[model samples]
Target: MKKILILFLSIVIFSCKKEEKGFSDYLRSLDTLVLPQKFSLNSTMNSSNKYDSILFKKYKHRWTYAPYGIAFNNERIVGIIEYSIADNGLAPFLITFDNNGNKIDSLNILGNSSFGMKGQTLESAILDTNLKLVVIDSSKSWQVDIDANKIPNTTKLRVSTTIYKIQKNGKIKKIK
Candidate 1:
């Protein structure tokens, strides 16, 4: 019975993840991730403080929009974006663009802490066939919040989450 209770609680906690509401919700998440499809190499990247060239659109503003890793499916260009706000930290975006600068699809995935709580600072991301996202969090174990009752904190545990199946509807299904 103890094992059964634990299993039941696990299911409950896992199932509590939010779901995508509708087209509007999905669209809002993807809007910030739109990118150029046919991108040329950056000849002037990392030149100087006043960098010149047209390959990168990122600047040292209040936030950073950058790419960590990218995956390609056949000819489709799939890119992962790591955007960090002023004091908030980094957020991940899974995006796919067509050959004509059109966005095929995008997924705005949030980072989770080792405490199993939702947070930020996603380091890298990769998308599979079903749009399932494999994310790596850069937040160290000490970054996760801890409280009483949630006793015996895993000081050695790090923030990491691997989502199994990303439904066509833009919902993430986490796998153990």
Candidate 2:
């Protein structure tokens, strides 16, 4: 009779232990999950300094959603040109897309008059304000200042950001 009671108590304790588990434990039981790609690189630079910008998806000029180079103005994509000026010199590039995947708009980001980037430098790039653009070199960060027309009777805030380059080895090093 004692054995039977002890076994019953152990089973009850084990059952209660399962009930004590929390949400985190329940989540851990899930299998490895993967997320789909929302966006992708539309195009890359033709040379080191000279880049050609192109949007991945196609969309007409949209007023509702603002579109930037190689990014979605809306659910669709629009093309753009990119240029970078660093201590190394200047890189002027034009990247555009064809009716399909073909690349067009061949313009060196930094003009030929200037020295371009050394190697694969631009890991990522972004444009701020209406005219100003920014590029993150392997060693340093650069900000492009552009003057543009703002909203009616409103003060404009100038924003700046710093970007780093990811090495081929998957390591990030700050550009000068």
Candidate 3:
């Protein structure tokens, strides 16, 4: 009986000791990350800041607009800009500039409903290993219902995602 008690207590103490390091401790143990070199813009950039904001058409409706993402290839920098039109969720556009910051082309991606449905929103975008652009467009709808405990619970939350690929010639292709 004494040996069994000692073994059980030892096992409990050992188990507790094994969990000494948690997520926070693990994070502290990692070395600081080194970031890549910053991009330098020339006189052609127009604005002195590294990031330039281009405004869209203004309206009295409840709407929001922002510069979403930016990526650079061998010779050009690409920016994804988004705007909201009240009942319509998000509309995104792509603009390209040369290395010297001169405007190369500006393409509106929402006119024909090719990127997503008429009212869906664009969430984010990033450049892939091949320098091709990968974009995420999403829409979400939710419903609440009463549970057995008389509490309102989210019974359904529908989320849809779309991935697009941007080619070198400034064409948008839905790949997923």
Give me the candidate number with maximum lDDT.
Answer: 1
Per-model RMSD to reference: 22.3, 20.3, 22.6
What TM-score quantifies how close candidate 3 is to the native fold?
A: 0.33
lDDT of 1 by residue, 1-176 (tens): 99999999999998997673432222223323222211111111111232221323421112335443333333434333433332233444445444333455555554342223432243455455445566556563333335433323554435665555544433345674
Cα lDDT computed for each candidate against the true fold: 0.40, 0.31, 0.38
Put down candidate 3 lDDT per residue, 1-100, tens digits, no spaces: 9999999999999888854333223222222211221111110111112222222222101233443334334433433333333233344444554434
TM-scores for all predictions:
0.33, 0.21, 0.33
Off by over 4 Å in 1: 1-53, 58-64, 85-88, 111-131, 134-176
- Residue-by-residue lDDT tens digits, candidate 2, 1-176: 99999999999998888444432232232222112111113332232121111221222222111112231111222233333433443343433333242333333322213222221233224433232223433322233335433334343333333433323322223343
The model with the greater lDDT, 2 or 3, is: 3
